[model samples]
Target chain A: MPTAIEQELRPVAPSKLSLRHVSKIFRGQSGETLAIDDISLDVSEGEFVCLAGPSGCGKSTILNLIAGLEELTSGEALLDGAPITGPGRDRMVMFQEAALFPWLDALGNVLFGLKLKPNLNNAERREVARFYLRLVGLEKQENANIHELSGGMRQRVALARSLAPNPRILLMDEPFSALDTLTRETLYRDLQSIFSKRRKTIVFVTHNIREAVCLGDRIVLLSSHPGRVREIFTVNLPRPRDINDAAVATFAHQITETLTQYLETPATKEAVL
Target chain B: MKRNLLTLLTFAAVLAALEVAGRNGAWDTRVLPLPSEVAAYIADAFTDGARRDQLPAAVTANATAATLGTATSTTAASLWTAFAGSTLTEALLVTLKRLVSGYLIGFLAGIPLGLLTARFNFFRETFGLVALGMQGLPSVCWVPLALIWFRPTENAILFVVVMGTVWSLMLATEHGVRTVPPLYVRAARTMGSRGLHLWWRVLLPAALPAVIGGMKQSWAFAWRSLMAAEIYVTILTGCGLGWLLHNGREVLRMDQVMGVMLIIVIVGLTADRILFAPAENRIRARWGLDKN
Candidate 1:
């Protein structure tokens, strides 16, 4: 471990987050269950990668591992050439539920994420928090209570909160899954805009193949039950791509078909639904 | 507003009916005094300090105490003075003071105790189990134990009141902290919040609605336990409202008894409305549990 003074003096390099043969096995009351198999993937700096598969695919578990919210059973998950043993400021995870504190207002929730930046004074932090809120199109709802906000609005605030800290890597576990179609579409556009504006490595998890196609620069498909990397699809689409665009739909369809075919094989045959 | 007026009108009509029934001897006035007479008795208790001849002997004797003593006065001199006489107003104030003090101390102390219960296994097995088991017993059961421990001093009443409050508050806090959704903690921790920051900033606020609920219930428990203690340990605890009620019963002053009962109900309602109502409403609104 580097000394505190050495850490401060050394300019931190933005190396890619690398997962080398990472595996996670959960010990429950019933027995030990393997959640993830040996999965080696490197998310480059400022890359938008989506982990896409069915429910039991351990896509979320992958995000948790990357965020250092879960311990690896085997192999190493590295950030900036350092092993990730636990959660830190550089890695922020946004859950499916907005998870915004009901006790706080919209800006208050964003300001809470800003608490990680100890050097920033109250006024500067407020300014930074407000900027992110405006980025997510919630500039006017700064003082609005979390409970007062609609479900879509709440998610927007959660997005703002996660982005406010300006983490090096954003690990999102199906943050928009619970939202309606229209809201999710709007959020996809907003998220794309934010991702481009604030360049950061993002590992997004989603079951929606279309959502993965619309958002991710590269989509990593994983097989269900002891999730392992199935295939990689690189989206060669233009910036700010629309989810309803024909090109996006075609890519989504292709990925879904390939995934279904692999899962339907006799040796590993399993029901998709 | 319309509903409130309807309730007020209904309450007033019931009081008026009771007044007429007692006046006509239909309800036996001696057994249960008219509402107007009870109100008059309460008024007399307040203003009849100078006119010794007209006032009830008990009222004059009690009210004749030099002045209202402080709530925490456990010194021998204060005890002697309190034993001499304590008025209806003094009794009410003393009870209120004990309820507020005992509950505050217990509630504050229980927050950490309850945190222990929810956070660690050893505490959960030992202290949490004790709190859970003790909660099942009625609060009045503490009065005898407190009397044996501290005698008829103010400590005995306060001890009972604290006993009534602490366990309930502890259990409530434990439940609140334990039931906080795991997502909130995960979100905060992933953002680099841990240890005490995690406890106060994330965990405590998340557990607040339940803690507020504990405060409300703890207030009621404290009030009840204080009353029970006052009834038995009546020597120098400044003759609390419970003592006044018991005294009225002994003297067959039905009006005084009902008057004290009315004050007790008023105090309960006032605490609920003034202290808890707005707080509960605000929390409900902020938490998205409110109807409108």
Candidate 2:
């Protein structure tokens, strides 16, 4: 453990979140179920990686492990060479549900995490929160209550709240899944633009193969039932990659084929509904 | 416009019917006094000064006894002695003491217990059920027990009021805590809030509406229990609305009893309408928790 003085003195490093043979087993009243079996992957500094798998395939369990929101049962998760014992400011997770506090308006929700930060006065905190709100294209919606906003708008607020703290690694668990297709597409373009400008390490989880192909530099496919890394496919596509492009389609097909094969296996076939 | 007019018409019709019935002697006067008679009684009490002198003495004795009893019971002190002033002042002091002390005790114990029951399943299983069971028993039922434990003093009445209010509050808090959406907890955990901070920042705010609703119910129960206990219990400590009602009954003054009953209704309704309504509405609107 780094001493507080030493930690303060050390320059902030670009976070490289890594998992080594991580596994999670859930024991319910009925029986013991393995959620994730020995999965190892590395998300390099400023890289966009998507973990793509079918529903209930433990893709979210991987994100949870990386965020240190849940114990790994086995193996280790590290951020910038430091082993993650629990959740910290360095890795922020955004969920499918916006989860913005209903009591707080957009600005207040964004400012919630910023308030916990040290050395910043009230004025500075407000400025920082406003900056992020504007960054997410919600400057005018700052005072709007969470309920007043549409579903897509709520997700945007959640994104602003997560990004306000400027965490080294952004962990999103199917954040855009709840939005309509058109809204999801718009958010994807916006997110891509932000990622291009900010160059933050993002681990995005999604079941949408096209989304994985569009957003991620690399897509890691996980097999269902005791989820493990099935394949790691690198997309050599340009920025603002078109989902309708032949190349993107080919890649999606190849990845989907591999995922389908894994799903068809007798043990997993029954589990992937 | 039509709906408003219809509502006004309905109200007028009811009043007109009541006036007609009273004038025609369709109902027994003693059992259900005419609205005009009640109004006349009120006007006489406030203006004629016929009953004014007796009012002060009754109020003073009741106020002193109530203040001293509750204060002595809670603090193990003789704060009631401070009531040795003018009759009106003593009455005011006694009412203030009972209301504040009883409310504070109920709130302090109830809120924490509510939180505890909400947080821990074991606590909820044991204490939640216990609280629920106790809530079913009227606060007035505790008067005999309070008298036995605290003796024939004002402490007994205070004890009864606290018992009446606390369980409802605790149950409300527990319900609020339980009903907090899982998303909020997950979101708070992601933001590195756990244990105390999680409970304070996320759980508490989310559960506040239910808790406040419970508080309103608790106050209603406390008010009723305090009046009943004061009237029946052997603790001759103070003069409250209940004590006043009791005196009217003893002197066979049905008009005075009706007047005191009117006071209770007015005070209770005022507290709900003026204080609690706006607070609850604001919370409900903010959370988007209200159905209508």
Candidate 3:
């Protein structure tokens, strides 16, 4: 991963979106099950926050609530000041699967977002789409079909599509979990640079501790089985922070240890309590 | 291209063997015409225009029936009347009308029903199994009931066509909707698409290839049913290719029977090759669904 630092870059002022006592329950033939339990967190604008946990920890469930893909059974998820009722154009999501429309080429996928913005003419939509595609270092791959692109390239296209709409907040659900380690690291660096440049508010979800440490300005770790935020860690590490840096290593170790301890805790402990 | 050529070669070899067997008295030549004789008969039918004269009567009747049927059912005047210049034109127009109208009605009803059954749990539970069960019923079985329901009118034929084609389309659409990757829906929802917007933008496009495949299957069904309906039920108005085939059989003119049969096969093949093949190819290619 290549990292570059250039000072004098203006920082985007923070805006906060908060969740208050949010709970989600899913009903099935098996019975009603709690997916998330009284999860509450606040995310500031232009801050890269990662929700890290084990598989089935409802990390994704929380992100979905924020994006309004799922409604909270109890309590509230608020964006800015208003309670989220459903998905809005202001909050976009990127998934582990690129989910690029196969029929559309790379540029077409980006343009699909821009065209949905309302009242943008053909030429303007084209120009805006091109700008974002170029931003993602995919200028030459504009006409390439989804299948023609590599996994990393497809994710880049997905990122460009998500960003092209210029949403107030970006929600990513294990976005790089599908990519190889090397590709994921490279994407992490590129994504960090893009985030710095755009300063868009982002809430990323992942199970990987190293990934969360490398990318998040703040990491929110959730405990599994009726997911609840276990701890929130702030990483004040400066820009171009090295993965090999002792501080980053220590932070990763601390988060992983905490997560492991949470995972190992017995379900019977709750009954005993 | 290579496969098509090989297939043609194989077909020719089989026909040659049959011709040689008939000529050598290995089989009765009277019951089965030699390949050369059939080819010659086909050539004469086209060049001499003997079969062409009989074509007019069949085409004229089918067109008249289709026009009357369309007029009675809907206010929209039939396009068949406009194209009824020659026997060939009339036959082509009537068949085309039946195909378009049947497919259109099937698509309009099937897609929504498919989507509904696919999306809503209640609808899926209630109707999905029923729809799948109905698909197993052969379209030809509908002819007698359709005739009775519409009283052997042009409406009866249209109904048969619609019934024959609709199930495949419905099944295809349902399958398409069910197979749409959940990730796409999540992604679309994240981008603020919901309800009709979600269906139009995400669900419809994702389900399109399957729906199209269903349409092709529906067309084949409609075509087959139309022919069968014409053979059994006397529509009393329309002149269909099936009527021509029946007439040939009635007159005991094997040459005419063979000629009409050739026309039917040629037209069906042409439509499949020219219209549906290109559209399907383009879609498959775009979606990366094609293996070849």
Query: Cα lDDT for residue B68, model 3?
Result: 30
Pairs with steric clashes in candidate 3: A15-A45, B61-B238, B61-B239, B62-B238, B62-B239
Worst 10 residues of 2 chain B by lDDT: B60-69
Better of 1 and 3 by lDDT: 1
lDDT of 1 by residue, B41-145 (tens): 665554433344445645553432233233224566645444333355666778888888888889878889998898999999999999999888877888788
Summarize candidate 2's per-residue lDDT along A222-250 as a digit string, tens digits: 88777888899998899887767788888
Chain B, model 3, TM-score against the native?
0.77
Q: Please give, for residues B193-283, the per-residue lDDT of candidate 3 as tens digits.
A: 6788879888888888888888788878888887787777766576666776676567554544665677778888988898689888878
Measured against the true structure, the TM-scores of the candidates, in listed sequence, are 0.90, 0.87, 0.85
Each prediction's RMSD to truth: 6.1, 7.3, 8.1
TM-score of 3: 0.85
Q: What DockQ does each listed candidate score?
A: 0.73, 0.62, 0.54
Record all residue pairs in model 2 with backbone atoms less than 3 Å apart, i.e. clashing. B62-B238, B62-B239, B63-B239, B65-B237, B65-B238, B66-B237, B66-B238
